[model samples]
Target: MKGDVIFGKKGKLSPMFIGPFEILEKIGTLAYRVALPPMLAGVRNVFHISMMRKYTSNLSNVLNYEPLQLTPNMSYEERPTEILGRQEKKLRNKVIQIVKVKWLNHLEEEATWKTDKDMRTRYSALFDKY
Candidate 1:
């Protein structure tokens, strides 16, 4: 089941270990571990990707070269770096604001609450509930 009809099998095998995207993603991970040098690792990764491309030709849900689509809001062919850069710029500010807001909330909560409940609980009603 490793290669394909390119080898000894005349017909397709039933429940063949071909793929679901999880296996293809796993191939990416395995490709990373292949005994290649860093530069060759990139090339080998592309090769394994092309191998995936051949089999996934018919499925609509199967993206050609993509492992996991990071954005559902944006399409892959849209050159997402520009979108990412803008989003990241916005996110940086938002995160800073969130941190400040959280700091203020923590201060407010500390002022409001004299004491917080402890986690440990004694179960006197265990058999009573049973």
Candidate 2:
């Protein structure tokens, strides 16, 4: 439930905000039934007041903004754009490989360190140059 996220972490550092969404009605004292995009149709739209934030006029404040693109199951794919760096971590006798990945539409500071195996499977093209 990514309710009106402006500046926060999303499974590493994907900043997203989906609002200016209208309040459909007040569900109770602390909750409001807000109108959400059709992509979020499968989930409940009612949110606690704490989840919502006051509106801001400056659009660029939405850091590395990327519009929510939902799939049939109401899930969005977060694609990594590039392999920024790599490292190897030693765990007992085994070595684990990790890569710093820059997600598409995300800023450099938001780039996340992910498992190299995971990146290879999900974004094989990121390694085509290597």
- Give the distance in Å from residue 21's predicted Cα in candidate 1 to where it truly belongs: 4.6
The local distance difference test score of each candidate is 0.29, 0.80
TM-score computed on alpha carbons, candidate 1:
0.15
Candidate 1, RMSD to the unseen true structure: 21.9
- lDDT score for residue 53 of model 1: 29
What is the C-alpha local distance difference test score of candidate 1?
A: 0.29
Mark the regions of model 2 whose C-alpha exceeds 4 Å error after superposition: 1-64, 72-74
Taking all chains together, each candidate's TM-score versus the true structure is: 0.15, 0.47
Question: Which digits, one per residue and each the tens of the lDDT, describe model 1 over residues 38-125?
Answer: 3333333222543542344555675444254456855343111110011111453452211111122123333221111110122223
Residue-by-residue lDDT tens digits, candidate 2, 5-27? 33334553455455778999998
